[model samples]
Target: MRRVLDLAWLALLVFMAATWQFMPDLVGAPQQAMPRDQHMAVMLAVAVFGVWLTTRGALLVARLAPGLVNLPCRDHWLAPERREQTLADLGDRLAVLGLGLVLLFAGLHYRALQAAQPSWPQVPDIAWTAGGVALGLIFALWLLALMRRFGRLAPVTTPRPVRRSSRSRDLVWREVQPVWPLLVVLLPIGVGVGLGLFFRKADDHEAWLLTALPLLLTAALGRMVTEVHGDRLTWRFGWLPWPRWQVDLDEIVTAEPARSRWIEGWGIHVTSDGRLYNASGTQAVRLTLRDGRRLRLGTGEPRELLQLLKSRIAGD
Candidate 1:
């Protein structure tokens, strides 16, 4: 859904370049209606699809979960302490974006309606031209602003990090190799195949949806990664926006490897000991925090991750 809608908008912007070749009138005022489907598609794409970033990029499940909002620097803004504000702002941004969408479609819709009659004052082609651009900008800017604000935010408890050489900085980074539990990965594929077989006659969108679900799930569950940078630790299901987390390096009191029980299962779970961030398999490194909070960080390379933690904390 997100990809298709974005492609729809991309088509108009890319085609808008044709103003030089054909619709040159697009640039100036007395700004005329984009005669064909260009304007219509922009409005539809932005209004229908630009609902403050789907996959908030359309919640690709972003609104469904803010921690996993698909930002590489998610740890900075989506920290547990500030999460509520994020949800509130996300709601507000979407509400305002809704208004913008209303105006956007209204202008484009009016232009379409008036395209036939010359006497109808041309609705300034701004709607067809800059409307979508502005709305999309709003989406991008909101997130950029969020990341900007939080990235610079001084932690109340954590101390600031000092400068380090490139080599030393690299030492602080570790990849918690993600693995696919064969059964978990195959379950979706199996379901999708059964659905396809059952619904062999399903239409294009339905078929796409059926096929897409397993593929998406497979991708989301396929990889897990963890990293430490700038005195912060971050991790995610490789390539996904949710089911990820970050922590200030200063918060940790100790780090060590632990064996996850079969009963613990996988994914994010709150156990009696602490919250668990598991990708797959039984291997994980448990971190004891200054606040006495515990986290079982799932990793394929526990030694490297443990070393990375030591390097970061020791400021090596």
Candidate 2:
């Protein structure tokens, strides 16, 4: 289902490119004496450029480090040393992902400047280029907040609650288990490339091709830096330095699986009163609060993990 949504997003970008290409009059009447053919050519060129940008983005996401993708999930994998390593690995991935998002917006801003057209209506250019950068930043911050909520930044030395039971104890959930949904970035690129090839309205395929490249590349790089571990109910997308979040059991309200057609593209949802942890599908355990409100439990669900949490919380 997630893949399907990605494909849909890709189609939207391709359609945008195609529409921009075939219909020049739609954008605006040619200001200069540039021939209609030249105007069409330029529009086509931009469409291609858009495709490239979209593709580049996807490629960046896919190329994240291998260790993030290959973290062990079995019980033995949870040895103290391994746990420490997981924490370290996750922190690095988050930092990297955060930095990557910042860079992405910066690059978008730069491109917007290069794309500025004084003679043409400034609104559309600003809307596309500058507005895009703004939106990207907003999205990045939103993602960062998610990391924070997951308790990614808490100091390791912070005093922790005492677990009286020796048989079972609360597992501190830190880094996001590396998951591969980052591949979704490719959806837009695929659509751009596919449309460019199939939609023969334009004489030049270069237009669509150009637009797909950059988006795919960027997506790949971003993917490479992170992975969501459905088993661990965590995501690892940082770089070499950064604290990984470790969501404590007390803060979690309810952890239940959820689905969404839009927001998450399809995964789990962890909500706390339909607010704070209100993230959409990504495979979450809904943490039910004392007020009956819910929060998110990251990606993984061990055998009877929810039962264990409930029993533990009840005792508390």
Candidate 3:
């Protein structure tokens, strides 16, 4: 059943790509009648609905053929360590798959550009480019959902310690330096800026791409700080006045030390089953919320931070 579903998904992806690539021919002349924003919104809605329906159909098939969809590791999700390992392995596999797809698309894009006629319409080029990006994002999200459905059934564990809430204290503050290795993210931004400057006279797209580089650089270089005040726990990056993330301490269901691989990278990101906010080291703390959402904060002093949070939660 799993293999069948996988093949079906692959076929669907191919179909979508082909449809997008040949849209100009299939739909006749391009229509710039609709505003770009409106057109993009409609396309996005259609893509989203298509993914949701495909996922729903896959689930229905699994329900109808439960015997075929059963996991090889029957009790794997029951063990915390095993579950984590399984998720991490899946993440690594997905990352490799994403990289390969990106490379494949890049090769195809290069070939298309090379074979293009001097007078070829730009509308088809834009359509094909947008379609490729949309397909990549949708496929990645679908794979993530598939993995989560397979592995996110682990039982909840006990919460870790947090510092006690003291009425006399206005706040509890803790800050750790982000991992130095995360700084490497700046390398790509530098390259992007250099290329953009070199091609400044070429197109408006280069200017737009350049304008976004600073924001990415800021996010990549931002520090992670955790602040606990009153009933709120806030996580912020850099000197940003507004918190990048915050949660009501009351909503926290569990907290524990969690490990991540270097490949997981840093900064705010979503996993198949949780959200990660890491700036540095692989060692961090994971928080499970009352609503089943998970958040991870990368920290160098995992034990100390965990104990403080545990005590705080107990005190509260």
Model 2: residue 122 alpha-carbon error in angstroms: 16
Compare candidates 1 and 2 on lDDT and give the better one.
1
Model 3 weakest lDDT span, ten residues long:
20-29
Ranking of models by lDDT? 1, 3, 2
What is every candidate's alpha-carbon RMSD to the true fold? 13.8, 15.3, 10.8
lDDT for position 175 in model 2: 27
lDDT of 2 by residue, 1-316 (tens): 2232234345544544453333333233345445435655564455444434333433333244333333334232334444454444344344444433334433432333234333321334555677667667765664654444433222233233454454333344332343344345455566676567557654344445555665554333332121222212323222322222334454444555643234433323333334322122344455554323344433444335565556655443
lDDT (Cα, 0-100) at 135 in candidate 1:
73
Runs of candidate 1 with Cα error greater than 4 angstroms are 1-172, 182-199, 203-206, 241-243
- Which candidate ranks first by lDDT, i.e. highest? 1
- lDDT tens digits by residue: candidate 1, 1-316: 2333344445544543332233222322355546345654464566555644532443335545665565544665567775665555444444444555555555544554455544434546765678678778866765564454344543344543444444332335667555566336564675677577557764554455556666666667767777777667888875666545677776676888897888988887656666687877788899977544577988778897888787767766
Which portions of model 3 show Cα errors greater than 4 Å? 1-135, 138-169, 176-208, 216-221, 237-243, 291-293
- lDDT tens digits, residues 211-290, model 3? 56655556545577876666667777765454346777666777898987788888766675476888787888998775
Q: Return the lDDT, model 1, position 133.
A: 85
